[model samples]
Every structure is written in structure tokens, then in C-alpha cells.
Target chain A: MKNALLSIEDTVALIASRAILFVSGPEHLLRSLPRGNWIGGTTSYFMTPEGGASREDRLFCTTFDDAVDARMAILPPNGLSGLIEHRFAHGFTCIVTPAFSTTLQRYAVDGPALPGLYNQPVFGWVAGVHLDRVGQDVPMVFDGATGAASADGLAALWVALPETAEVDLDIVNLFAPGDGESITFPEGGFDVTNCLIGGVPTNLAHYIVARGVDTTLPLVADYAGAMVNVSFQTVDAENGRVRFYAPVVPGTIYRLARTVADYGAAYAEGAREGSAADMLSCNCILNYRYAELEGRPTGGFVGPVTFGEFAYILLNQTLSRLSVRHALAA
Target chain B: MPDGGLLPSVDDQLWARLLTGELDPDIKTLATRLIITRLRIEVAKDSTVLPTAVQELRRFFVENKFAHRDLAAITGF
Candidate 1:
């Protein structure tokens, strides 16, 4: 089971391989990959604090080309333009290098390329997940308004996936039957537990207790009814620690009843019971939101990973427990 | 009061002085040199002129202490 989860690492490796695969088609010749051009195809950059001369600190970029290619290779039914527009409105900037071909020019942003555009850090976890599921590239754009002064913002890069590729939800149960039996709240009605997920330290639990109108006492809520879905995101910061979290329904009954161990078990169980075709996009804000709920320090940037790497991580980590309704045809 | 208030019509007088090469030659030379240097640096940077250029301009202002209107007119800011 552990080995299976490491398959996400394989997905990361595969995507890295694809990023270096710079074969030019018959129509165009390959040119030198220039400095200052944003290099990560579907990835964005972020910053981290540092000491000494590195005081003007910045985040590092990781390659995830394999999943990006898989998603872009398979065009989504509605196309990627709408997704691109959606991300732009959310304050992401997209840059396309000449290697992707200048003929695909109609979608380019108008006005001269803004100076110091790439100097800021990008938050792109959601888009990276989407590209991993789909196989084709979506247009990326940056928003100039919000966080432009501080150089802290989010960007989404989309790529279309093959119509044939399957996206499904997989769940597995990692806890024993009595592992998460009872959860007690501190004076505040919710207890926050700090734990590590995907190599990141995160606050895993926080919920509001709901009191029924009739009873003066607060009652434990059932979170399952309130939550449509759960998302987990892990980001590596330059500070040698990764930040991560899982978000569920808020202001609902489930907040009082569930434990972090219970949630993990549910996640594993979901993999065991659900189909394999649904795609997941882990929100980058999940960790910060968790920290906010727990009154913990939440400061750090989420670095960019290609779509392929995200998918690889998702699929490998949850595959066996994943309810495999359909299989990729050999 | 004299015609057109107590102040002289300095614009015409300054123009005449410049035409006659009677204005301070050192100030003219410094202004011309600064303008040419700024233009060349602007072209080379291929972006906004660096902070150093702005600092240099401020240093010139401190040394000469020109009137606000004159400085504004000279820089065309």
C-alpha cells in the first residue's frame, strides 16, 4: 500500500521527463530557452524569506511537465479558453514562450508585457490539479491589480487532457475502527491538531459546534451532510518545511463530531469506495485557512508544480483505495 | 507701480540672454550634459531609468537649488 502511494512520485518523475522533451515539430525550429522567460509550462513562482544577501528572497520552481502534457494532449469538451479567463479574473498572470508557437497568437494578452511581471510569487495549486486531470493546455494570465505591490498572488495554468483519460475519486481508510471514536473540544468548542501531510506541517482540525434551538447544550454535528467534497494541498516552502491542509464543510454539525484521524480514514475510505474518473484540484488556501481557524502562524508561499506531477501524486497516493470504476484501456 | 507689476518680464530677457550667449555658460553646459546622459541611460536600460539616475537628478537639484517652477519646466516631469 505504501509503495502504491509512492506512485505519485513516479508521476512527478514522468512529468519532469516530459518537460525536458523539447522535440520541435516539422513546422518550427527549436530556439534557445531564454532567461527571464517564465520557464515552468503550467507552473508559477513564489517567494520565501531568507537571511543575508538572499534577503530579497524568492521561492523555487519545480517541474511537472508530464501531467501537464497528459492534460493538454486531451482537449476538454468545452475547451480551455473559459478556464483561462476564470483564472485571470482571480489574479493570475500567464506567459507563453515562443517555443509553444507564435501562430497560436490570437489568445495573447493585449498591451506591452508589464515590467517586473514575473518577479512575484504565484499560488497555482488548483490549476495544477486541473491540468493533471485534463490533457490539453489552457491559457494562463496574470492579474495586475491585487497583490501587485507586494508580489504575492495566485496564478492558474490550465491544459486540456485527452477526452479518453479517466478522472475519478479514490478513497481509503487508514484508521482502525476505534481510532477516531471520540473528539473533545477545548474551551473554544473545537480542538486543532498539528500534523504533517505530504511532508508539510498543518493544522488538521477545526470546526464550529452547532446548538439546537430546543437544547441549551451544543451538539456534535455530522460533517458528511454539509461537505460536498474535501480537498488537501501540500506546498514546499524554502524554510525546509512543507505546509498542507484539508478543508471540509464549515458552520455545520459535522465540525463537532469528526477528528483528524477520522477524516484521514474517511479519505482512505472514499478512495476505496469512489469511482476513478473524478478530478481533484487541491486549493492552496486550505493550509492557511486551517491555520487561521487554529490561531496558528500561516506564512509561506506555495511553489508551482506541473499538472502531471499533481496528478501523479494524487493517483499514486490514492489508487488502491480508489474505487476503480473504469480503467485506462491498454 | 511699474507696468506689469514690479517684476521684470524674465522670459524675454532670459531668451535674449541665451541668444546673446550671456547666460551662465556653466549652468547651460551642466543642463545639456545631464539631459544627454539621461537619454543615453534610458535607451540602454530598456526599462525605466534606474534609481541611481533619479538620485543623480536629486543631487543636481540640491547643488543648484533652482525654484520649483524652473525645476519642473526643465525636467518636463
Candidate 2:
């Protein structure tokens, strides 16, 4: 039998359980959790092994804005160092949960209205497990940026052991354009890439070229229109334990399109426009990046289903666009 | 200043006065706004029932005035 460590499933389950507890309980549930901007737009709960009753031990519950502000407020004159020191002494653990709202739709050339679908509010939740023992006062550097403030933000769990932990990171670019095609730019003040994606006829070739750079290219900006997808991942290896974290569920696919006539229109109206590309919505997975960079490890990895869906959508869109462009140019 | 005893109607202001010492100016402002908003909502629900509640609340505030008036001056409102 294969040796089983902490599977992504186990981590997600823990996060989900904590999230449920937070949402179902008192309003003050968010006040006590580890505070930060990444935890924004989400509810959070923090508990320790020795904490008292749920009500008494529960730390805090608040909106993302409040959470960020609170976290910012606690920073000391030397930045994150003070906060890290406090965390070392407290034996802290935290859970962050996010609530997303929007609909994803896919378009087909044959139909006036393309086949559409909606994804319900998917919550991104993660648990924090502290591996370090309390009382060893270690000198740690504190970078002020909200995401880079702590080790947990950069990777999963900071184990303060007798010896320092060594970790390796792999950053894989998942999108790129196909071979032999080139997109040249018309020199001037114009942002060629943005122009092509945003609706400038002269910039079409540039968009194609930009897509060529990434093996995981997005759908052709002209054919598919504009899309936004969030992508991020972090792997933390420490003390014989490897923790995988996906800020957003990689398998959860969300199709999104521009709802407004133009970029300005969309911004003014505060919504989307055009047709959806699977996985076009902001990938919650990036939250893991924010957490990891901040030295906080949001416990749990993105489930396989979500990861598969994200990868498929990313690959399909890029390859499909390249194929179409190749045929059109030919 | 009696511990845990119900103060007379005239002494209701003592609660606010006392609370002022324990809370900072910003906290005082937030607490006041919270209390006022709650009172306003209650008053809106039943205007007739609010006068008593408002009087009691005001009295509590007056009696419990902070040691430093600077703390009471901070108004989130």
C-alpha cells in the first residue's frame, strides 16, 4: 500500500469543517483568527487545542476589509517581526473561508445565445496548523507587505524546530502559444496587447503574438473576447511533511464573459461582458500564493477535480486558439 | 460605584461614565455609535417605547462619564 501522508482531501475537509463552524456561529468569530488582506471577502475562525468553549475560544469573524484592517493595525514598528513573535508564543491556528458570487457561461459560434451554466457560490477555505513549538525565540525577518509578512503566507506551516527546514519550490507556467506563428507590434504609445484584447483592429496581430509566448495560451482575444482567470499554487516541504495548497479549487470551472459593451462600460456598470471561457473567473487558487508569500500556509491543497478542470480549461483554450489562428493565417 | 447593584434612575448615567475609563476614545466613539444606532432602530420600530430607553441610555452615559473628557469627545458619528 502507498504511504499516505496528508492528502489534499484531508486538508480541505479540515478547512470545510472550520468554515462551517465559523459561518454557523457567532458574529464575533472572525475577531480572533490570524488577520490579513488575503483573508478578505471571507469569514475566519481560529482555535487551539487548549482553547475553552467554542464561544470563549473562538477568535473572530468579519469581512475581508475588516480583517485586512485589523491585521494591518497589529503590525509593530518593525513590521511583521512583532506579529511573528506573538504568533510563536500563542500556538496559533487559523481557518479562512471565502464566498464567491458570479455566473460562468460558454459561447458557441453557431448559436445567437451560447449554451450557458452557473456555478453556485463556491467557498475557498483553508486551515492553519502550527508546527513550531512555543518558547524558542528565533530571530526572523519581517517584510511589511501583507502577503509577504509571514512564512505561512509564502508556504505552508513554518516549523520552528531544532534545525531549519529546507524547501524547494516549482513554478510551472501552464499557458503558451503554438509554434511558427509570430505577433509583431506597431510601435507607438499604444499598449498593443491591451489594444488587441480590448478591441483595437490594428492590435489583433499583437494579441496573437503575446499568446505565442505562453505555451498555455488563452483563447484568441478576437474569437473568444476577453477573460479573467486567477491562477496560483504553492508547495511547502518541511520536516518530512509536504503541504500542497491551491488558493482556489483548481477543479472548479467558472465560465465568464464581459457583460458590458466595452471595458469602460463594463467597469462603469460593474459587471462582465461577452462570452465565457471555462475557468475565466478569478481563480481562488491565487489566494494560496498570497498566503504563502505572507508566510502563512492555508492548510490544504486544491482537490483533483478542481485542479483537473482548471488545467483542462486552461489547456483547451490556449491550444484551440493557436489551432484557429494557424488555420486562419494559412 | 456600587458593584453589581442596580443604580437608581438618576444614576443611570454612571454606567457610561464608568465605561469611559476602560475604553479608548476610538472605542468610545464606536460604542456610542453602536448604542445610538441600536436605539435609533428601536425607536423606529416603536417611537413611543424609545423615550424611556433613550433616557435610560443617556443617564447611563452621563453617570459613567470617562475620567478624561477627551475620550468622550471622539465621535465616530
| Candidate lDDT (C-alpha), each | 0.24, 0.23
Q: What share of the true interface contacts does each candidate keep?
A: 0.00, 0.00
Shift of residue A246 alpha carbon in model 2, Å: 18
Clashes of each: 58, 67
Instruction: State the fnat of model 2.
Output: 0.00
- As for candidate 2, its interface RMSD to one decimal place is 22.9
Q: Which stretches of candidate 1 lie over 4 Å from their true place?
A: A1-151, A169-254, A260-267, A273-330, B1-77
Superposition-based RMSD of candidate 1 using all C-alpha atoms, in angstroms: 26.0
lDDT string, candidate 1, A5-63, tens digits = 11223423433444311111111011122212122222221111220011111212333
Candidate 2 per-residue lDDT over residues A252-325, each given as its tens digit: 21221112223222221221221112111211222222222122211111110111112112212110100000
Q: What is the lDDT of candidate 2?
A: 0.23
In terms of lDDT, which candidate is strongest?
1
- TM-score of chain A as modeled in candidate 2: 0.22
- Alpha-carbon error at A66 in model 1, in Å? 7.4
